[model samples]
Target: MQVFVFDWTAYSENVDKFRENGKMIRLGKKHFNAKTAVDTYKNHAEAWQELERYGFDGVAINEHHGTPFGLGNSPNLMAAALSQLTERIKILVYANLLPIHEPLRLAEEIAMLDCMTGGRFICGVGRGAPREYKIFNVPMSESRGRFNEAFEVMRRAWTEDSFSFDGEFYKFDDVSIWPRPVQEPYPPIWVPLTGSKESIEWAAAHDAAITPGVFPGPMREDTIRYFAECQARYGRKVDPNKISIMVDCYVADSKEQAVDEYGSHLMYLFNTLLRYDQVWQEDVKKKGYYSSTAFEHLRNGAKGTLAEDDTVFNEWSMDTVRAAAENMPLGTADEIVERIIAECDDAGANNVLLVCNRGDIPHDMYLNQIRRIGEEVLPRLQAHNVTFVPHAQFEQAAS
Candidate 1:
């Protein structure tokens, strides 16, 4: 099993100062503090470097814009820095938003990172959050088409000597990129999904690995099952190594201790930061970002937000935190290991992405958590191997 830590790289200091009313205000230059932003990047980079020393296989970063939720507006830039800062740990952009980017340039940049890191880069692509669409002034309805065309352009740019693309969203002629990717054909492409059937099928068709995103256990299993079926339709077999699960984890002396320390940050994540520049799911659906059945299995007959139900957000409290912690991998190292392994086993996933930092926990505390995960959780997880894909097995049995 490969273990990766996902960092949000949020603006860490004085988080409460950014809030207006009860909600987080859209952060702009006024909210920006140069020292705070610098420290945030420096601390996260230091933490990422520590992952290499602590024996983590990779460190994952993501992109967001115009919010304090994640300062990683250009995850590619972060990955480039990581290539220089760390020696061995894979730097996963986990994803670059394809729809909003010029694909040829993205291709060249990723190739540069791949060459810089000597093929230790994983290219994760996605259509991005609804808020990002708004920031870029892109039509949410055209996200799928743009994402597909962008990926095709990048793919061609990476593999072909000279390629031309004339697509609805992008047009290029006689494009041959310098600094070709170190990996043959291209670097591994991974997609982080929110249980969208269309996204799953698209990933399967492209033979990209997928992380089922953060969701409850049942929904995650359904995603894997559907993905396996999709892979089979494309004449491919399910590979455990190609499936990854993202889980919010914390390691402490006991479950109670873990919850007591990490619960507030978790709550803040859900109640405040995540809601910054929030776009409601109903609006997203109306905009055609999601098909009618995209999230049918997970929806509870209520219009939810992109990641969770509106009720969950509205009803968030300490009780909600404790309840959520029950399912999360939070507890002693042994307990966390057990839960993570069980989740991976049940979902037929061999890779795990641990989200241990969020909601602007103190820098030292964040480092402590990473150190503990490295010393305690990492070894156990690294030792465990997932050998079979349950989804594929189930499909065979049904057939």
Candidate 2:
């Protein structure tokens, strides 16, 4: 039951500027303001401080490229900023897009952050969104191979004093990186996967933690179960703590108040800021980018615009969204606690990543929501023994 907070610190204000045009790379220079960009980071730091104060086990930042959905073009940079600003809680980047990065440089930066933070970093990695491939100009067809190779290289780089590696995308000779991570072997490597069998198998073989990113409760449970099946096939035992699930959440004095204050922001987040429309599918398919089994499942019954597929936007009713949210723990503090317990029990997941801010939710209101959860919900959850355990501990023992 170790709980963490996640936010993209998105440039939500710029939604109107790019939503219609559907051009992400162009949106940066034409629409982004330097001051506003700086402010976004500053604001994220400020909000993270509040999360730290609320006693979250960790604060998770996500990476997104060429999109107004998030400003964390470099989640490592955000992790660096948070390293200096907070203490005690882990700083998770969920995650860095491994395919698009130079592996050696990325590995060194992560090592530096881990050492500098005194082992408060959790390295979360992924293949990344389809649009990210188009934006970064990385071949989507090679994404899984690239991610696998990059991860293998980084692991060797972090653990070996001096290493040489030759891989399809990255190569090095007798290279020794300075500032080895403080964590033994390395800090936890969390692989947040949707539906790639290769990715799931890789994570299981490495004993890395796995999470069902942004999937709903039932889907998340199914994914975790699938991961366990993979682990068993590989002769590995599944640890529930390594199976985390994400939920969009807020807590208030009453269910009604929670909905009234948080409903619109949640709706705006799903419908506009986080919308995955037909454009993404067309581009990824056209370019042969890494395909997601999860996305395919989501698109199964779609007739038009995969966007119209079971999204809150397609439902187009607060009642619909609220019903779904309620199932995932979005209501009063008591209700949230109960829902979270039930959801975790069903999924056999011990870690929960909660998203509290999105789509112009006022900073003050978000802080208040955090305060309420911290004071009311968290204390109750303590009975469940929600604690943070590094994935390295599990991997080290298995090794």
Candidate 3:
């Protein structure tokens, strides 16, 4: 049982408000505009270092947007910073958009980071955000195909010693990448999907992993069943223990305090992400997939409502968010830890990723959340044998 904290860095500064009137909680920094390198660097600095010092086996980051909100688009830079900041802790980058970049370049960057970290890197690649593809002017029709090609290209760039590739998307006369990654055969690749059975089957066939985030939702049972079925279809036995999930969490010294500080943020998360059928229209639904439904249900359920319409409702009140946050796991450290432990226990989770700041939380408060999780939650988790063995397993093999 590994407990990995995750933060979406969602800036609450995005949209205005809804009918319910609660601000639409965001998952990425409000980068509809642009952010100066100086400003972004100054903000995420402490959070990065604290994760390294904390009890986490590894520190993780994902490329969300470009420049501002999804600014970590170039994770090698982020990894480089992490290399200088911490002595240990695996640097897990959910990945450089495999489809959008030159595979050889990605390979080189990954290898360079691995060497810099003394081989402490776990790389995961995706087709880049579908929305981002539009922003980057990438052809969405070819996103999946391009991703598969780049995935192979990046690997060959690291492993083939010397090779050539002439694929539909990537064409290289010499598939040679300088400075190979330290991990043999390359780091593990986990495909993040929205409970797509095809995805599970594909991952199983390649011995890859999937983070179906739709886990632990209202359709939780169905989601698990689908994954199991996919594993079987792939003829590769998958230990439920190997599957991981992403759940929103928060903690405090007292339940009241937890509610006070985390209430609005939590509610905002549900409504924005799980907007109860609000985004189920074919267009909005097609954008992200059925998992969009998951958000709708989760948000609706949390607010004790039924999502019967598809009017793309955004109406919410701050009061609603405040109340939802109150009932959630926000509580004293002891109480919060208890809840986290219970989640891991029930799910038999091997790894846990925590999404820390969803709303535009004050930077200081975000750092405090990390520190609290590290000091109070981590020790008890390990003592109770709850956290899994490796949030990251990027240590260099014994020579």
Task: Give the candidate number with the greatest lDDT.
Answer: 1
lDDT of each: 0.85, 0.72, 0.60
Models 1 onward score TM values of: 0.95, 0.86, 0.77
Model 2: residues with Cα > 4 Å off, grouped in runs: 12-14, 17-30, 216-218, 276-279, 290-319, 386-399
Q: Flag the better candidate by TM-score, 1 or 3.
A: 1
Which lDDT value does model 2 have at 309? Answer: 35
Model 2 lDDT tens row, 296-380 = 3322322222223343335235886668665656777878888777666655568888787877676677677778878888767
**Candidate 2's error at 148, in angstroms?**
0.7
lDDT, model 3: 0.60
Ranking by lDDT: 1, 2, 3
> Which sections of candidate 3 miss by over 4 Å?
10-37, 66-68, 218-220, 230-236, 266-281, 284-316, 322-327, 384-399
RMSD of each: 2.0, 5.0, 7.5
* Poorest 10 consecutive residues by lDDT, candidate 3: 390-399
User: Residue 269 in candidate 1 has what lDDT?
Assistant: 84
The candidate maximizing TM-score is 1
